[model samples]
Target: MGIISEFKEFAVKGNVVDLAVGVIIGGAFGTIVKSLVSDIIMPPIGYLAGGIDFSDLFYDPTGGDYASLDAAREAGAPAIAYGLFINNLISFLIVAWAVFLLVKGMNSLTKKAESEAPADAPVEPPKEILLLEEIRDVLKAKA
Candidate 1:
């Protein structure tokens, strides 16, 4: 078969389609998690930490006289943005927690569904067995 046909077959598969959908949803979820961490969650924490701006938390190794992180970057000074790393770490933890909860719920639902499903029918004995049983019953009656 041609490469194009092979590619088409692979792309049309259920697993590949499911994976593509999952990737798209995961990207969207990541964006939501980023926004949740930066906008909703960090503001309160920063406020409690005496109005500190987590995004601007950085260290200038060169000891430049820059006022802020932007100024340091503009002045071409090397800096480590530890606050941003903290924000990202918090976001990762939140996402992981949300995924764990979701998986746990899904597992419970799957188990419930499996438990509720009807069982298979029992198998019957073969014709020879049935015939032998009938003959045995008749002989016992005569005795």
Candidate 2:
């Protein structure tokens, strides 16, 4: 086959399509998780931590005092943004937990499906067996 045909065949494959769908969904999921972390979860956390804004929290390696992260960046100063790291860490934990729950549920379903045996149905005997039984009946009648 020509390369173009081969490429077309590969592109239209089920696995490739599934992978593309997964990537798209994963990107959307990442966006949702980011929003959940930044908007929903972080607000409460920051509030509980005495009204600290975690995103603006940073450490300057040069020991330069900065009012905010943006200010530090504006001055072209290097900083270790630990608060952002913390937020990301929390986000990662949340995603991991979600995936774990999903996998656990799927595994539980799989196990249940595998453990449940199919109902036993009566199977017909072979034709030879039936013929033998018929012959036996005929012999008994003759006797």
Candidate 3:
């Protein structure tokens, strides 16, 4: 009823702990996805695009000649960083795809588990009636 008790109840709940774990794993997964995009995938694409560095892909709006995106940013110039955008778009797609596959696999697993359970298992009988019926049949046979 008190604030401390409510806080204790919330902290002890399994859902909150599971959520914390998920957040930690998601952060780690994000780092791996970022590395996979920037290190492995983008380099070859940049090479095909005439050795363009995706991070350095930008244009200065101030009409000043800047060597790279970093330089333009350092010079306080406004620029459209389309290359970084592309990289981020790809990362988003990859992460989405990964999550989709994970969810699909989990769904399939759950369905499999459900299907494997016995369909004929007792759903209703209270058990006392069955025992009483057996006792009645035994007494009738004795008579």
Candidate 4:
């Protein structure tokens, strides 16, 4: 087969289409999770943690004095942004948890579907058994 045909075959496969759709949905889900963490979840947590903005929590290794993270960056200070890492970590955990629950629900549904399906019909008796029964019936009738 030609290269173009081979490529077309691969691209048109059901699995490939499913994977592409999954990737698109996953990207959208990631954006939603990021927004949820940054906007809704972090605000309350930050408030409980003494009204601290975790995104601004950083350490300047050069010991430079700065009022904020943007100021530190503007001053060309080398800083470790641990707060951003924490936010990202929380987002990742939440996404992972959501995926886990989805998988659990899908698995339960699959199990239920399998259990509800009808079983295969039972096998009939062999031809030899039928023949023997017929012969026995004839001998009994003759007797």
Candidate 5:
């Protein structure tokens, strides 16, 4: 097959399509989690921690008079970006908790669905027995 045909076949595969959709949704979810951490969760946390901004929680080794972490970094001063780390940690916890709840709910729903479905429906007779009965009837008629 031609290169275009091979590419088309690969792109049209169900697994590849599903993977692409998953990647898109995951990216969107990450953005939402990041926003929740940076905007909604962090402000209250910062206020509780004596007005300490998590993103600006850093210590400069040189004790330079830079205004912000970016300024310090731009001045080539050594500083620990602990605030960013804390923010990321919070985001991880939130995402993990969300995933746990989602999986748990899905599992419960699956179990409930299975339990509600009828399980003891009567089985039909085998086709072979029906065919044998027909054959016996035909033979008796001939006799």
Candidate 6:
């Protein structure tokens, strides 16, 4: 087959299509989680922590006084930005939790669906019963 046809076939395959869709959705999910952490969740946490900004939480190795992590970096100081790391860790936890709940719910639904579907196919009678019925039918036909 031509390369064009081969490429077309590969693109249209079910697994490839599913993977593309998953990547798109995952990117959107990541964006939503980022926003949820930065905009919604972090604000309250920061407020409760005495108005501490996570991105500003850094340690200057040279013990230089800077207004924020950005200021330290601007002044050419190698600061350990543990606060940003904390924010990212929180986001990762939230994402992992959300995925876990989603998978759990899907598994429950799948199990429920499987359980409700009965596999009780009709059983055939024994060969001896069939032979007896055939003989009875023949006797009746003769009568």
Q: TM-scores, in order shown? A: 0.78, 0.76, 0.83, 0.81, 0.73, 0.76
Model 2 Cα lDDT, one tens digit per residue, 3-63: 9999999999999999999889878887899899999999998999999988888999999
Clashes of 6: 0
RMSD to the hidden true structure, all candidates: 5.5, 6.2, 4.2, 5.6, 4.1, 6.1
Model 6: worst 10 consecutive residues (lDDT sum) = 114-123
Where is model 2 more than 4 Å wrong at Cα?
117-143
What is the C-alpha lDDT profile of model 4 across 17-136, one tens digit per residue? 999999999999999999999999998999999998988899999999888888999988997888999999999999999999999999999999998887686777999999999999
- Point to the candidate with the largest lDDT: 4
Candidate 3 residue pairs that clash: none
**What is the number of backbone collisions in each predicted candidate, taken in the order shown?**
0, 0, 0, 0, 0, 0
* Cα TM-score of candidate 2: 0.76
Clashing pairs in 5: none
User: What's the residue-level lDDT of 109 in candidate 4?
Assistant: 100
Model 5 stretches with alpha carbons more than 4 Å out = 2-10, 62-65, 122-143
Residue 63 displacement in candidate 2 (angstroms): 1.6
Q: Residue 105's C-alpha lDDT in candidate 5?
A: 100
> What is the overall TM-score of model 4 with all chains considered together?
0.81
For candidate 4, give the lDDT. 0.94
What candidate 3 gets wrong by more than 4 Å, as runs, is 125-143
lDDT by residue (tens digit), candidate 1, 16-81: 999999899988999999999999999999999999989889999888777788988998889888
| Pairs of residues at least 3 apart in sequence or in different chains that clash in candidate 2 | none
Model 5: lDDT equals 0.91
Worst 10 residues of 4 by lDDT: 115-124
Report the lDDT of model 4 for residue 79.
78
